[model samples]
Target chain A: MTQQISTMTATETVIQAENVNIYYGSNLAVRNVFLDIPPRQITAFIGPSGCGKSTILRCFNRLNDLIEGFRLQGRITYHNHNLYAKDIDPVSVRRHIGMVFQKPNPFPKTIYDNVAYGPRVNNYEGNLDELVESSLRRAALWDEVKDKLGENGFSLSGGQQQRLSIARTIAVDPEVLLMDEPCSALDPIATLKIEELMKDLKEKYTIIIVTHNMQQAARVSDMTAFFNAEATAEQGGKVGYLVEFDETTKIFTQPSQEATQDYVSGRFG
Target chain B: MIPAAQPQKSVDLGDLKIDHSSRRSLFTIAMTILASACMLLTLIPLIAVLTYVFLQGFRRFNLPLLTQLPPPPGLTEGGIANAILGTLIVVGIAAIISVPFGVLAAVFLAEFGKGNPLARWVRFATNVLSGVPSIVAGVFAYGLLVKTGLTGYSAIAGGVALSVLMLPTIIRTTDEALQIVPKEVRMASVGLGASNYQTILKIVLPAAVPSIITGVTLAIARAAGETAPLIFTALNSSFWPGGVLEPISSLSVLVYNFATVPYEPQKQLAWAGALILVLMVLMTSIAARLATRQKTY
Candidate 1:
């Protein structure tokens, strides 16, 4: 399928992927992806499992660099800076674009330390106590965790831990927040709370999420990109491609592609 | 003709029958007895050794024994204080020598060089080194350090010998400890913009500290009781240990020397020294247990 451009103005786009091909060694994992994520809005990547949504999401912050054989072709740009260029350090790139993983993985340290870790590593020259407090407040976790900030992060409940992870990610003051299925491991009530938090966060940070839940994409995202995988003869066995990209309401109500329609209406994936 | 098979809709709890004397029960009882017998068999040697040592050593295991120096062959009122201090100094030096090198090598194996050719050869070398006898380590250290006149029959040479024996255990245990840390925890660190080195130093190493401490303690325990290495390296000193450059008297070496003498008093003191060495090793093992029991992550 051809690339589908959304109605959003290009001037507002904070991240752009142009003709990107992701590979693990010689095997192509995702082929020819083009996406433009606008600032201060939620962009959700919706797909079935093994469709490379998470893989592409990791590319934004160059988190894929940790995998031994991962490689990316073409370009991913954050505000016209070529992220894969020779001089660009992945560590610094990560400082500007942070990530929240599917499973909430807070450090084994105290809650305060967990939130302060990123800033400390980045050498943030500010009042650390205030930063931790604001980050926790912005994550909607301050009230629940404030009294026990000295406790180990592992002591918290699953939902609160996930919130703590969010607080930790934001504490570094990243311009973009990449969440890979942030609420998948959470209960419905916790998921709803996170959805509300995402709605609140979109006002400040450029939020890009990869989700398996269609309703979550519908409820929380401003733009939605639908991806689908096809069987391939390559060693990787399957290759994912973007099937459709548009406003969330349009994609949910009347998608241009049959696959998107089938996926959204519960006919197929 | 086959009767119509009727599927029971629900279980009747009141009518359920359980056989109390089935073959399974008999097998379970037989296995339980065998396991208990095996456990008791294992405990016998430990209890017997402790009981015998306590009985023989209690005669000389008095305050004077810990405070006074080793007396002449016929005298009976002397202490093994010099031996105790020598053992502590030698073992402490061995720990200092082995711990840093072992941990760094383990870090290389577990993190930076995993699955690489160099790491494979390192692991192979560590395994072979661990299998090498403690006597061989003593000889190697004697040839390298003591015979070279770098440190002649001194505590430093003994430390080098014991450290050679200690290194492989520390490296292997620390590697295993680092390997068992959750992958997600590492990913979380990396995702938070930490460089690989920073992640290892700040997050990974701290999380593995408890297990690493356990390994070091066990290594120290093994080194403290080593008599063969000290025989070749730190040869016995009649007086108190002068310095690291001079010969020293450890509890194990004292035990080996006095146990074979013709005098009965020296022989009694030897039993007391053996008991002290055993107690030290036992305490170290208990410390290792407590270290591992702590919640590290």
Candidate 2:
């Protein structure tokens, strides 16, 4: 399943997670994780279900804060700024770090309004029409939707709606794009389209994706982090942790950990 | 060590049997007839009321009925136009007062204060308030406004009383509508850097507008038919309504005041007023249906 893609050698880190642990109420969810994300490259988190890949991805932009009793320990720094600092606003954090969800959730609005909503909320004083057009172009949806800007967003197919969501996210001009299983709901052809889109998006913004599809991780990501879950003493409770993080090609071809080998070889039960 | 061999069982693939029982068919026919009888029984009262109102009211349902005030005891020469106008004024004022407060309270309950202790208390209060008797609302208004001599027995007091009746329905429906919006839609807005207020105002509220309209219209229809509250608050007048601050008449109160009189002409006017009130409620229901059919998402 390994597909060769151009890889960039590590430069200075754009985001760093140090000794991170996440919890919900009294129970631990993900424990002891350290990882660095570099700028202008695609980093993929791949693991089985309940491995906290999505949870860790959400932490990068503080999206997990929406859940009740969600707590994060240790430091997450973005470009040397402590993301968890008492004064840092999660609202502003999300403005700089945009997200795409697992399902294609477009606002019940016109396609043009859907893309323009971010800029309007941020009080953008430019020609909004230009910004929406360029964002749609970057997300590879402009040509398909150029003629019908006033159509409701839900009128489009699932893949087009997802692309419109991506357009809506990028319309805010974020520095980082965090995608949570963006293609899990799409068919094979739609999934391939989004994979190609990710490869194109990485040249401008740092991309972090969490996916259960290992072949997708192998095909498009420059770096890959593998996470695995272990059972707790409490019956049926599992806590996720980082198993290995390396260059995607290296991780897929010659991983250092036995668990990584089992997972990549599809031997995991 | 191998055990003895086992014999293979032959597979049976017989045709499926279908039931065609005459007794079951007869029982089904009997049940259908019984259900139809119950349904017809339920419609009897409604049809009788409508037919009786139409037969009696049409005798007096002319142009003058919509343009003139009610005549003296046995004259039978005027209409209940003042009562119609007063009903509109009172119900309009009630909608204006209740809609904003109810929707804002619903937003608080559904979005900001979802699991808070205050929200639970507010929800409980709303349910109790809805169950309070209509006559009690009228008496409360009498004590609060008429007895206090702030507005006396005026249209303003009547409007306030009707608004009290409308608030619970508006709050309950709008809260349920706001909650029916998918959680992911809110997340999408938040993920795009929109503030909580911005998300609610632009995204969540718009999605709930159709249901909100349906709720507000139903509340208005209910408020229009209420007579007990207006009896103490509005205090029916013979003359046309001069202003909202003055005593006013409504179709419900006019019907109540005139229906039991010994004069034949006044009783006919009461039947005509009842017919108009029924038409108003029917029109409001149709408007609500049309509103709910609008494409929100």
Candidate 1 colliding pairs? none
Q: Looking at model 2 chain A, report the run of 10 residues with the lowest lDDT sum.
A: A1-10
DockQ of each: 0.74, 0.74
Native-referenced Cα lDDT, model 2: 0.92
User: Model 1 reaches what TM-score against the true structure?
Assistant: 0.95
* DockQ of candidate 1, scored on C-alphas against the true complex (2 decimals): 0.74
Highest lDDT: give the candidate number. Answer: 2
Question: What is the C-alpha lDDT profile of model 1 across A175-194, one tens digit per residue?
Answer: 99999999999999999999
**True-structure Cα RMSD, model 1:** 3.0
Residue-level lDDT of model 1, residues B1-297, one tens digit each, is 223343753444532455558887788889999999999999999999999998998878899788778998787688999999999999998999999999999999999875599999999999999999999999998999999999989999999999999999999999999988888788878888898998999889988988999999999999999999899899988788899989999999999999999999899999999999999999999999999997465
Return the lDDT, model 1, position B297.
53
